[model samples]
Target: MPYALYYWPTIQGRGEFVRLALEEAGVPYDDVARGPEPDGGVPAMLALIDGDSVPHPPFAPPFLRAGRLLIGQTATILLFLGDRHGLAPKTESGRLWVHQIQLTLADLVVEAHDTHHPIASSLYYEDQKPEAARRAESFRNERIPKFLGWCETVLERSGGPWLGGRRVTYADLSLFQAVEGLRFAFPKTMKRQERKSPRVVALRDAVAARPRIAAYLASERRIPFNQMGIFRHYPELDP
Candidate 1:
């Protein structure tokens, strides 16, 4: 049976991270939430959380359903998929290290999401512009460099090509997504900082060039980044 991925239909959001791994691994899966209601759409996604079919419900979207297993949380899902799809190292320590890297990336994703919804996720961007500006300023100045610099260091330690040494692991895919989101959300800042993180930039490019990943990105299956997604492009906040 093909794996079933449940996430919001419209935006890339956290779901995109899982999608990238599946694509890179050439795994055939059903993007459940993207289908029609009767065939598992938004209602199906909500049912997983609000209904009782799943004994262990996920608190939010981006959960993967594989046979009897239901996995939630972006990092956790990626860790599971990474091991199963050979997108992680063979050693236990290496897998844990990759999972640790993914957790740190998750931290970056949350901070980036907060750039627009700093005060409250319930509030609209227009309602929280001032606070968002402040949050975004700090993110652009401090957080972006810190996270990207750490990724660069990891790549340096790996001695090139991929985060898992010569192999392109899920961590590498997540890092590419992070770079893409950061660039879209903070083009000005990313452009200026890219000079300092050459390895990180190269990794992003390498991931983009992978056969399956490249095809998936070019296909309509890849959702575009928008205001509703985690990485929103607000010109005022970025500047």
Candidate 2:
């Protein structure tokens, strides 16, 4: 059976990270929530989150249903995909290292989202422009460089390309997504930051050039970055 992934249909959100792993692995899977509601949609996704029949209830969207197993959280889903699809190192230590990098990337994702919604998720960006401006300033001036520089350091210390070195892992794919989101939301900041972190940029470029990833990116299935998503581009926030 094809794996069924549950996430918000309209936005990539956290689900894109899981989707990247599935796509890069060349596996057949149903983007459940994106399908018609009668079969798969937000209602179907909510069944796993709020339904009484599910043995393992996920806290939110972006969970995966693989046969009898119900997996939640982006990191956990990616970990499963990495191991199952040879996207992670074979050695335990190497796998842990990549997982660690993924968690760090997750941290960066949260910070990026907060740049626009620093006050509350329920509040609109307009409601917290003042706080967001302050938060985004710090993120642009310090956080972006710190995160990108740290990623560069990790890759440089590794044996070769990829976080685990030589072989591409799910973490590498995720790092690419993170970089892309940052570039979309903070183009000016990233243009400056990329100069200081060429390796990270190179890795992002490399991931984009992968046959499967490239194909998926060009397809309609790939959602365009919009203001509604986690990575929103506000001229004021970015400036």
lDDT of 1 by residue, 92-172 (tens): 988998888988999999999999999999989999999999999999999999999999999899887888788889999
Q: After superposition, how far is residue 193 of candidate 2 from its true place, in Å?
A: 0.4
TM-score of candidate 2 versus the correct structure, residues matched by position: 0.98
| TM-scores for the candidates | 0.98, 0.98
Q: Write the per-residue lDDT of candidate 2 for residues 90-178, one digit (tens) a residue.
A: 99999999999999999999999999999999999999999999999999998988888899999899956888899999999999999
TM-score of 1: 0.98
Clashing pairs in 2: none
- Mark the 10 consecutive residues where model 2 has the least summed lDDT: 155-164
